[model samples]
Target chain A: MASATELRRTPLTALHEDAGARLVDFAGFAMPVQYEGILEEVGRVRTVGGLFDLCHMGRVRILGERREEAAQFLVHPNISKLKFGAIRYSFFCREDGTTMDDVLVYRDTDEVFFCINAGNRDRDIAWMREVVARYDCELQDLSDDLAMIALQGRASVDALAPLCTGEPPEPVRREGATGPAALKYYSFMRGSVCGHEAMISRTGYTGEDGYELYFAADKAPEIWNALLETGKSAGLTPIGLAARDTLRLEAGMALYGHELDDTTNPVEAGLLPKMVKHTHDFSGRAALEAAIAAGPQRRLVGFTTAGKRVPRQGYTLHLPGDDGGAAIGTVCSGSPSPTLDTIIGTGYVRSELAEAGRTLAMDIRGKRQDVTLVEMPFFKRDY
Target chain B: MSNPTDLKYTASHEWARLEGDIATLGITAHAAESLSDLVYIDLPAVGDSITAGEAFGEIESVKAVSDLKSPVTGEVTQVNSGLEDNLSVINSEPFGGGWMIKVKVSGDLPADLLDAAAYDELAAADAH
Candidate 1:
């Protein structure tokens, strides 16, 4: 019910408007949807370089006497699989197995840095505090004091290499922050970026090769301008949330409200393997186990439309037939893929009909149109 | 976001051109500007009957999808099929190459349509 003006503004809000971006409210914060065009930004991120302002997301630091033990209460049981200085994608779930929110966990020696969805920040913070009360760990919300920017694409490595002036530590290299760019994927290092203290991580939701730079909130505008100027020659373009959705969908990544929600469990969402078998017995483990054992009655899958007409969310998916058509599922997220040059979407289909290559149809304005279940991700990089 | 003086405008942002018994229709430049960066368009087929104030087509930009309503009652005689390949022309040349369809007048055109100045007044009021 809130207007874009009522949403919180990031430190770089002025900069975005100055660049002629179309701003809209997203997750309770005014955010840019695109500077020029979604198609162009999508193409640029896949090929060259792209920048995204992700300042609206919530950032929290967890540290204390029993940080390791407390993590099981804070995140998924898969926290054990994440190495120090690395980032792992996971979900924060309720005891009923419904998702509270999805988040990215960054492991440090004595603490975990958590990046949560912007809209759920207040609720997530309160829940984490209540859940971790028994433990010695403390949860600190850092959202108001930090700004995050993502530099993504194949050329992002070389573009960020110049910022790391010193011989980067091995931990930094492992998390995709090495200056020479030998760091593996999903890694990060805390160091100086353009003379500002920053955490540069090799992680992005766009499914492209990229880095995320987190810095002090006050330094956001200067750092954003600096990155634009420095990376201008490398064909780096400022991307908006519209392009962000298309890029993630093409990569088969999940969005919070669309693919994963309060009623959607990780197993049914097709993320069962990463459930991390009771490693420390985290919350929602029992329900997740039961769901996994019951074999997830509904499954999320990808489909490509036969025509340019995009299948929007809530559109009923039907199985084609000569006599009375039967409803099979519903589209959760759908859009015209700017990169693929056609329509693509994700849907929850009955488990029996979730196989790749299965034929499906979507009721587009009362007319049933043919669609095909395809292998996710809808796209992939060569190397 | 130009509202050409020669064209009559609808409050819904459509523009009408009445030439003899033919009415050429397209979205105004202001409409295209408000719906920045066109992505897809579903143009009405020729021979489809359209009534004034009724939806005749659909247009989608990156962030949202909007309906294109008819400003005059008529039977569609032609559609700008070129939009099937290039929708951005709506942003570049909305009045000319981006015209949506041409219709043969059936009944009387809507009398409530506004000229350029009147339409501009409506636009300004909406802005406030």
Candidate 2:
């Protein structure tokens, strides 16, 4: 582990420090774990609104005429089928069908953008460079040059719509409208936010109405402060990574290191059915097809604990009546849901025992706690 | 906040209020604030023996789990079972209603226990 002095700081580090956030070393970056508290931050996002500094996440742009073909061959999704100004959840997989990293592919007029995890940025870029060598496309690492911010929750549109100026052109415009209001889910528009050029996309990891803005890294503080000041009355607070984890878990989103790893395949993680298009041949398509045909041995399942004790990651899952017996599965992520007021977790369990309403026991520090499998996502917005 | 002058503290952040052979144990305000938003606490039942410098219970916050070390070697005579359901008291009044257990001492209290002034220095050094 790197010491505090050796950790890297984002462009908004000064702002986070001024807000009295608890800074911790996350994935080699000095990031805010919480400002007020985890539960309070989670409440703000679920209720009114919250702001997130996502500059640490990686962004890569694939340029040239062959960008679409190169991207299509790299990820599981068919990038050619993606319409202009649209985004699709995709995965970069190894030859054995295991995930290297799960990314969001955005198709623009001239270039394709890949939003990747911070920890996997270097490896993903290296792999992309090697794979794109066969085509006439070039990969540009835009992580240090651009800053990403996500404004999420119920009042997101009202908070951000006023700050954005001008209109999105045809093909990028949804419903023939302008600004954020004109955009639809998984769509983006090139516009100016707070007088700076930005790519505002209607996308988020949190299960809420939100928008992710990508712009100049130098103007991060100005835009951050502006959004907070404009949305002050609507109870917009700056959230940190701690609440981000709980919020994503409550929404049943797959975290890269936890739910999706090199050893785990998309079929077992439940993304193959919807996110992957098998018509086009992509990397790992053959292995993925074989794995799908053979069926997944263990599957990812969401569970709710009967007690307040959180079934944390790496904790062993057992049969209902067998506490110290052989492990049936292992917990990937767990937390006490501030919205649902119960302990919830995701884990990989045997396919035969992964049905809803089935009871299982989790060994927490030598004691057995009851947990019941349930359908995800645990929470969703009415809108 | 200043450490309570009347109690003795352990390096692990547990505080003990000694009255004759019985001692009341709980975490300090500094410990509780650092652990922030404690959601659950697991304590030993009455009649369970606990050793000084060893974990007698566990406390969990939103993102972390920590061990609660005993400041004295003794058998638990009373357990504050209400903390399991309402752990906010541990955060709001860590030195008051947050008292976790009452132990009847079996041997001498650890000689390494620090006074209020000494514990404040230790906590202050840890803050940096």
Candidate 3:
């Protein structure tokens, strides 16, 4: 028997099993890691479309007299610059400059909706509530009431437009909105999705053109089935968490456990520039300031293998010479890049050796393989 | 999943073929089905010594990576070089063409390994 806390089921649990998905516990939810296989799903999403059930993630709404003011205090100070109907990728930080949770903040006329990681839902809400205890803002935990599904790939809009059935609300011209809009990267508008009033965000964890649909929980099964039915004709495949990891790795997206952890600072993770906003004070400002002045000692960098061997997490990355270079870094995430036809990985390296074109080697099966340092976003496709 | 009666099996899902004193080892059909697709494989050197129940090689599928444990202690005499370019043989013909390594038995093959019928019963019970 499964413990009560062992796993939580989404509304589409039966659907996932019916589709032959291999279910595994992820962030407390019994999520699918693959339907048929990871590679096929990865390639399918890159070429066509993939439907994903993202209902396990948390959602909270901040509204009241001081909503925007309160949300600014909750997120990084740059939250104020996000235009209405646009999403800002940011993190909530602790006083020591460690990330509490990375989130996507969606701005609206009167409220700010925060989409947070599922594993940290309770802690995130409690922390935000305690911090703004004196304020007039209301933090409503809407996670249980809402469901999210992602449709991603070059054929995403092609499969999704029919379900929308109406015009996108108002143009929200914020940074990164046009990129998703031109490619429809992150521009979402409230409209009908499969006959249910829904909010569509052009964002995804997969490195492809995609839209995340947010709707009422009760309607989840219908929407999911509709997507799978409609998407089949457009070559859309139902993907799982396994493909999610590989696709994101190829695109160089940072995952919570592998890339970002409490002990690691975002600055050292190569996200310092995005974390800093000179406009106003926010949480973790002082610690981040100190780290900037002192300079981060270690940094996250990308490396590609010389051959077919995939360097996995915890693989030691060494400098080419100096007797394996004294173990300068450890690989945090890695896999074979199906799109590029090579093995690639992300790891933390000494700041001095993090630059692109630097040569490094990783020990695979007790043998060193040549690798090259490159800038992030290993795969970029035009939507 | 195929459970060939001609092969001797281990609880670790490896099948061993004994010809004289040389035993050729490969994963079983059930193991291949569980692993899904094979992408990358790391084989032990031809002359490396392997102990019974010890990991001799690693194989990676798209989602997971697992080490293949040896069924018998031996000195590796030969390895299936074709598997370097054709790892899918593990999924297609795990009993024959998918044989991984050939070993010269260091001692008697590890005792208590299951026969084909016994392995089928073990696999069926595990499926629950």
lDDT leader: 2
Give lDDT tens digits, candidate 2, residues B106-125. 88888999999999998876
On a 0 to 100 scale, what is the lDDT of residue B27 in model 1? 92
User: If ranked by TM-score, best first, what sequence of candidates would result?
Assistant: 2, 1, 3
lDDT of 3 by residue, A1-383 (tens): 34323589888877888887877778888888788877778888888879988889999988787777778777774556766677877778888889888888888777888899988888999997876665777889889899988888877766776666544445553444322243234556677778898888878887787888899999999988887777878788789988888898988888877778788877888777544546767778888888878888999998887687777888888878655457889889888777887878899999888899999888765778888999888998874
Query: Per-residue alpha-carbon lDDT of model 2 for A145-215, expressed as tens digits?
Result: 99999999988988898889756556656685667878878888888899999999899988988999999
Q: How close is candidate 3 to the true structure, as a TM-score?
A: 0.91
lDDT per residue (tens digit) for residues B7-119 in model 1: 88999999988899999999987788768767678888999999999999888776567889999998999998988799888889889988999999888778888999999
Error of 3 at A99 (Å): 1.4
Count of backbone collisions in candidate 2: 0
Runs in model 1 deviating more than 4 A are A1-4, A78-81, A165-180, A322-324, B37-39, B106-112, B121-128
lDDT of each: 0.82, 0.90, 0.81
Candidate 2 clashing pairs?
none
What TM-score fits each model?
A: 0.93, 0.95, 0.91
DockQ winner between candidates 2 and 3: 2
lDDT of 3 by residue, B1-128 (tens): 65988778988888888888898999988888778767778888889999888898988775567888888898999999889899888888989899999999888777878899999998765541
